[model samples]
Target: MTGWNADSIPDQHGRIAVVTGANSGLGLVTAAELARHGAHVVLAVRNTAAGAEAARRIGGDVEVRELDLARLDSVHAFATGLVSDHPVVDLLVNNAGVVLLGPRRTSADGFELQFATNMLGHFALTGLLLGALAAAPEARVVSLSSITHKSAHLDFDDLMSERGYRAPSAYGRSKLATTVFGVELDRRLRAARSPVISVLAHPGLTRTNLTPRAWEHRGRLGRVVARLGLLATQPVEQGTLPQLRAATAPGVRGGQFFGPAGLFETRGRVTEARLSREAADPAVGERLWAAAEELTGVSYL
Candidate 1:
């Protein structure tokens, strides 16, 4: 738990990894590090051109696959093709996300954009890829959550923020949902005696493209916060270490969450971070699981 960094990752020769939104930010870093450690990483991204560019930058055994997490059809197609092409998957990093979306927006599937992209899509993808993950020597499903989730609560009746919306609130709820899904997944996998483990991680206050992109709709306010954000963020290289540790560290267990070790968990090396009381509640997990299954129409242990 102390002094951990990407260099601590074990040799991953021959392992197969799939990372969502791997073209930039934490996702790109996660993919690059895994590949650097000898894993054949698949950069699952929305833009094929950008993904290709990212692959070239990564300079390793990497492939680009298009996947738009906001659309269920795309998620289904991506997972189907991936599972068929790669029968055994060692790692699935659910790292793609959008934040501080200024106005209400919906996905092709009609769900709130933030909820759909950050949580529901990953839920369905993980369930669809369960078989490939289970077949591995040891597999991990790493769900990227956030510090914002600690301040949010899920209201099942308003899961999609259909009645009303606020940028930060909606984003927080979406992250909370992702956190719940990760923990519940561990319990379900354990009960089923599955070999695949579920892990959680968050890059605290990292300088990423998500924040500036998210605030784009707000115009002037966007520019202001984006600048303030730049002042507070840790470097992308350091921001990525938490998830990297979660993915490749030895002795990491199901449901374990990795985050920064600094004050307020905003910046530092990788370490164990506490889950919010709400996120750890079994009842919340059960309800969120049912709602997710109902919403996404994907079911698995």
Candidate 2:
């Protein structure tokens, strides 16, 4: 098959898309491009001011809603509002996530911050939005994974890194959980014969505010490196290709993963990404799903 790029995006007129973390970085670019292609995009972000700025910058049929993924109540409210306003959502992009923090912090619900925000929150959001997604003629749920997942493992006992926590380790585990959840969700959706499909993608080492912000809490040197990384790495527009392809590309299938085609999947054309043995394991996914449900009190097949 031919390689996929932003130009490969099919006509998305009449589609309704909800992109988490659309205020900046990869999410912002994804939302802007989708709106450019005629999809009515909703920027579900934590900061309304930033989201409004993003909407203005994107300058299309775009709307902004407040959503802090670290809080389950906020997730429920966002989904409920969407379901009432837009009955049928054609695309739901689970792209909001956080990376490396200085110390272990707990969310409003008391779960580990990274795990709660990156994995559990999206899982709950997907389930809450499942009804609207399935109501569409054919809806797709695209979860953003990471290349970091390749080096991670799910320590069930330390799922939240409660026993001990390292910034990179915690972040890796959270991303691995996200990728595995996407695969598992696809399996369940297929088994249930639901019209909704789950797809996963990673932005190959794109320079985004996330890394620098991760270090911002530390000091000036960390922030400077992040700024330099953006200039040195792939552009945010290119970084969004994988998720956009997964969400809108023609002939795309559930459970398939996409990422950059360059060295180590860091930056290049969009193509099927490699999954680690740990990420591809269904048993592990199932167990993680159960744990996620228990943690968030949100359940779905």
Best by lDDT: 1
lDDT value, residue 255 of candidate 2? 95
**Local distance difference test, each candidate:** 0.92, 0.92
Worst lDDT 10-window in candidate 2: 1-10
Over 4 Å off in model 1, which ranges? 216-221
Clashing pairs in 2: none
Name every residue pair that clashes in candidate 1: none
Best of the candidates, TM-score? 1
Write one digit per residue (lDDT tens) for candidate 2, span 37-148: 9999999999999999999999989999999999999999999999999989999999999886678888999988989999999999999999999999889999999999
Cα RMSD to native, each candidate? 1.2, 1.6
